[model samples]
Target: MTPRPADQRFDVVVVGAGVIGTAIAARLSSTSARVCLLEATDDVAEGASKGNAGITSSYYAAPGTLESDVIATSYRRWDDVCRRLDVPFRRIGAVMAALTSDEADGLPGELANAKACGVAASIVSGDQARRLEPLIGPDCIQGLVLPDEGIIDPMRLCVGFAELAARNGVQVRFDSPVIDIESQDGRVVAVITPQARIETSFVVNAAGLFADQISELAGGTNFKMWPRKGEYWLIDRDWGRTLRHIVFAAPLPDSKGIHVVPTTNGTALLGPSVTDSDRRYDKTTDAEMLAHVTEKTKRLVPSVPMDRAIKAFAAIRPASEKKVRIEVDEVVPNLVHAINRSTGVSSSLGIADRVAELLAGAGLDLTVRTDALDHIPTVRRLLLDPEPETLAALDPRYTQVVCACEDVSAAEIQAALEMAVPARSIDGVRKRTRATAGRCQGSVCMAGVTFMCSLAQNRAPGDVVVTAAGTAGA
Candidate 1:
């Protein structure tokens, strides 16, 4: 397919339309910066942004690292953003459990580290851990509790940021990968994408796993990104609320170990078993990994029925050199890096805020306006109970549950498409309204979702596609 035309010369060109890029773009939109958010994929959150546990993180991160500072600041700002955008967020709290004596010994240092990073946390015994999260394993010796920890639908968070940014005049271009970045006299001059050439004075590299590639394109090549693969499982909704907080296993040298999370959609999620892979784009679920996650999670929540697990999926974390690498490009002065490996999702908004401040202080013409990031608050697309008052306020089709498994209605799907940056694919709809992302994983709801999407987009069923590459039958 031929690439699209560039809308205009932008003041800032953000590569990668994942959660971080979207957030950065949204924050930039809050300023007078003319920004272009570009993505290789056809939709936002198509990379690391979509598949993680969606924990808002308690900032139990290592102190003195860029990750620590960004997460601490982001956690504070997240509450306001969630409220303003009407993003579903719950501060269900978090617990970092330690089982072995060695693990127990590490708690003080970790707690001390978190405190240094400005995270409000304290150590508690296994009994206290159980009190905080009743489903915790009895064998757990102790845990670090951060009451401010929480969870938010990461996909929705990205969409919300993109929508709000778009409303404020940020040009978002999907299916436009940055293949080249040109610099002149130590300043970034332009970004070359598959679609068009985007001329910009500044560039923010928030490309997640592809950060190294973008850096290379911009004339720096000191870093490399390794894909740390993580696999997860989702159980029924009734099973989700069984836990009151996010649970965690003590960290190891390479990665944060798997922990069970109760998601905002009322489904219990487990796994994210850490491993390494060479491939940058593989999300294949490993059976052995699934089995391992199930066993480990059962140990944490003995009452959880393994048979009830309804879904299994995997995601990759872009390991960014153990530390976050956010700095002005040494080779290209106008280029900035906003790469984080471990807590990218949790720290996305904060990083955006920092990047904005950094750019503004650098003498860029950035004007922060109240109306710049206009987020039109949306009604709950998946209102499980269609009370008369709700139906009266919502689109009429919401009364008909199109996806029985996820309880997504036709009106909900339509509203998702009608948003400022409405979903353009089944995955987008899944993220926005939970249309086909349930226990059946679209097996049951695929046809209905396709039909509804076709109707909403005014296309025949065959004209509607799952992604740009995959088409549907009419």
Candidate 2:
């Protein structure tokens, strides 16, 4: 995947386009330095960012952990950032349920940990928990209520971050995987991607699953990362509307046990049962594990409607003993490694700020630009709007629904393909515009969406795949 020749130069190059990488790129855009964001996939958030519980947790790790500090720092900023970027975010609270006496005994410990992390949490009786969310199982004895735990559209959040970064003069290139690193005198000079050799003084390895390999290529720290897979079932909005808050299982040491988490799209996400594996790109879902997830989540909330299943998705986060890794590479000073095993979407903004600080300490001029944009233009979503007639007048293409289940219009799909980091495939359009991601799962509108994508990309319909172009698997 080596490029032919060196083409362009930049002051900083940010690798990966997950939520963390995009956030870092957006933060770097405020500086005067020339920044470029590179993604190995066909679009942003094709990694763990694409598939997650999507909860903006108020408290995740232990006290004083970098993960906790980052989550705390970014917790209060979501309201302002989401407003500016027009990202969908719901500040719905979460209830950590305990179904037995042994699990209930851990409630006080959870409360203490939340307080130590400066999170707003309190212990509630099962009665109060049931009152808070009537969907709770009758067997629950106690609950830890986190009022700040919220749900967000992680895909839109990442997209908005990259969009604002691109608007502020940060170049973004997709389908460009880093092939090699060129160093001179123990300093990174350029990065070799499949598309071109990008000359840069600074390189940030924010690649999620392949971050360790990126570090190895840059002559950075020696570390290994294994994939920690989590399986989840997407419940339709019909049942999602019945759940008021997130219901969680009592906890496990290495993972948060299966739970029923809500998403910003008015749907609920269940399970996310964790499994350790060496496979980096295994997005396959297991029926047995899925059944386990369903059963566990049912115990968490007995009233949950299991018949309202939309689909199943799996995501694997890069895991290591260290939960958060945001520091300058010991072997390569200019090459910074920014890796967050978990809480990536929740702690993304803080990670970006921390990475910027590291880059500044490394002699990169990070004087904030006065003329940088504070926000990008707003996107009109049919789901959020009440007056479809008014919208159809502004653009008649809005009258043509490309995704009936999601209320996605042809105009929205077109805009997705013509954005700062435009959609290149059918999955790209689905990620941005939710065109093919509805309850129908593109069964009714795949042909129309594919035709539109074909016309926009100037390729035959056969060339377009349902998934992103450079994705690892189905």
User: What's each prediction's TM-score?
Assistant: 0.94, 0.96
Local lDDT at 108 for model 1: 93
Alpha-carbon error at 432 in model 2, in Å? 0.9
* Each prediction's number of clashing residue pairs: 1, 0
- How well is each residue in 1-474 modelled by candidate 2, as lDDT tens digits? 443456999999999999999999999999899999999877889998988888898988888988888998999889899988778888899999998899999889889999999888999999999999999989988999999988889999998999999999999998899989988899988899866888998999999889989988888888899999999999888788788898889988877789898777678899887889999978899999999998998898876777789899899988976778999998998998888887999999999999999999999999899999979777788877767678987888988988988889998988988888778778888888888787899889988998988788787777776775332122
Residue 84, candidate 2: Cα error in Å is 1.3
- Per-model C-alpha lDDT, please? 0.81, 0.88
Which segments of candidate 2 are over 4 A away from where they belong?
A: 1-5, 386-389, 469-474
* Best-performing candidate as measured by TM-score: 2
For candidate 1, write residues 46-138 as lDDT tens digits.
Answer: 888888888887674677667777887788767778877767788888898998889999889878877887778899999999988888888
What is the overall TM-score of model 2 with all chains considered together?
A: 0.96
